[model samples]
Target: MRIERKERADATILHADLDSFYASVEQRDNPALRGLPVIVGGGVVLAASYEAKAFGVRTPMPGREARALCPRAVVVRPRFEAYVEASNAVFDIFRDTSPIVEGISVDEAFLDVGGLARISGSPVEIATRLRARVAAEVGLPITVGIARTKFLAKVASAVGKPDGLLEVVAGTELDFLHPLPVRRLWGVGAITEAKLADAGISTVGDLSRFGEHGLCSLLGGGVGRHLYALSMARDPRRVETGRRRRSIGSQRALGRRPKSDADIEATLVAIVDRLGKRLRTAERVCRTVVLRLRFDDFGRATRSRSFLESTDRTDMIMAVARGLLDDAMPLIRDRGCTLIGLSLTNLDDHDSIQLTLPFEADHGAELDIAMDQLRDRFGRDAVTRAVLVGRHHGDDAPMLPD
Candidate 1:
């Protein structure tokens, strides 16, 4: 059954994305790094400036390989605080432009400017002003893509990267989208792109011609239908604001170095500690613990466990996380894990948890609250788990606010 989608007549949705966000932040703060190849993070390439990207430097690549690719690149450790501050400033501009804003990450957002045609001018005009404001106010390069649909807007922004603005007018979206490579479509990652390439479907037009049934036969139902819809420029989603995050999590990239079981456990402990603090601070509780591993070969594995009841206690969440990690250890050992991450999912407001018996005391919860208070009062380093005392957990990757 094909459901008809009526897209907006005007291209009002804007996708504003900061170029090479972390690396750009570094470059903006240091005049010497501007226009020069810059890389953020010494162990892993968190971000690379366009100058470095021209030399094939990409995120998650090991520092050694990145240096080999761009020897002149100035590598700097990630300062997440600075990135967060810059993100806040950019988002402030987003809100000032439009009340309907959907933040995709710390560096990108979707905004609906449909109703501001009179007061703010056309979408293109608003985008130009937005770009100017970000440069004048925050001193960062942001690309804005305006389209009738969120998907197309995001794609336009990607095409008009490194400080540019593009608008895909209504009735001409197909003309703009069809000539692009299949990889430009959402959900078409490297593996999917390879699969499509094997079948000689290289462009969006080719995929659209292949039809949904053919794609389903090749790529399974969900992904195939999705790609076909996108190839036809059929996205109907609108910019949504005030959406609370469904999950709170953190991950640490461990470079291509062999780690012992103890080392892995310590990393896990540190991650859980940070997540627990964040969850409690947000007044949320999670019922599921998920462990994500990226192997040295770049293959990924995920193992998750859900509890009957949700809690914000660090010890309880860590216990489940440890169990999931334990179950995945054999696979990690075989694959040579290079990264470890955790997500606390199935979240709800703290008030949703049923009241405990009046006399039933949760010492673990008390401890968690106490520790969070100390961390809040002093600093994140004020309290630490014994397991993470002397271990280097690596930088906490910047993320959207929970």
Candidate 2:
């Protein structure tokens, strides 16, 4: 008797995620840390091991709290460089498995294994081999989830946490998802969770049972309908590399508090200079500048300006950011700022420069270029702003791109 093979449509996509990435890396590197609770971050928990997570430790929680939860937990500062290296190695393995890889983050990716079933065995077999290779070579544990759609594949991986594998067949997605809580839907946070709870809509089944009109009446049109659609596992999004990030942003903590205007200006200028160089290196230009401010009271505010034309000029970016600062200065003063950040959005990829307005009078792009060249030739510290040096004690030098 001939047995029928599983349909190719049933197993196509795979979501691979490293298990407790940072904490696992620390434990893998040091044998003594194995089987013990591990929390990784400088002053807080960037990642908590499964062992520590049992005690209610979580990422971004204070290190003191994590230690209090699991007194035997080994706390280690984050080794970002090491994590990046391991991520690259794991990605190489992903590329070997399939060409259609979509990276969600450094530690997770969606792989299109649709065409590989002919030569590479079934999706389950491929996932097993991929996980084994990563464990044997990269020395890290990872979980793999296989499903017909990207959304369900990610949910499967989440359900199979900490080095497990789960697969949901195509027609069984609703059966697998409806029993879960509404919080499982993307963009449903604490606020929305409470709102859903108030409406007696707790699970995905409840949301589905509420029907479209009921959802619209309760949560309004857009978000309510969106959740209703997802409750039925109706996502049509694909796993393609076509979706590139439109903008890149970085934020730094001031640690204590900022004092003067000039000091804040210097910090803003440095950040803009760094961000501009990165944009140029990526050959992209941004038409919008955003300034983010976090007050001592933990309130955050953002101000943005859209430019008529896109430019990656360091001085120009800072000038716009400074203009945003002037607009938000009163609020910043009223609520003393604890953190300041800069971001450039509205990006166009590798486009020709569209010069509309005249460049600022006092600014010098040549000086910026010279500094860049010096940093390229000698080192990042070869050039520096005198104001940034020794202005704040224990302040480290700006990081140069590798």
* Collision count for each candidate, in order: 0, 0
- Number of the top TM-score candidate: 1
For model 2, residues 1-402, the per-residue Cα lDDT tens digits are 112224455668899999999888999999999989888753446688999999999865656667888898887766766888999999999999987888888889999887777899888999999999999999999999999877889889999997999998878888999999888888689898899899898999998998988888878899888988888887766677545566666554453345577767777766776788778777888899988876766688999998887877787887899999999889977887656777788778756775457665745656767777887799766777776675532221122111
Candidate 2 lDDT for residue 97: 96
**Alpha-carbon deviation at 252 in model 2, angstroms:** 2.1
| Clash pairs, model 2 backbone | none
What CA RMSD would candidate 2 show?
A: 5.5
Write one digit per residue (lDDT tens) for candidate 1, span 1-402: 122224558898999999999999998999999899999887678899999999999988988899999999899988888988999999999999988888889999999888788899999999999999999999999999999999999999999997999999889999999999998998999999999999999999999999999999999999999999999999877677888788977877777778899888998998899899889889999999989898877889999999888888898898999999999999888888777889998899999998768686558888888898898899888888788887776586733444
- Score candidate 2 by lDDT: 0.79
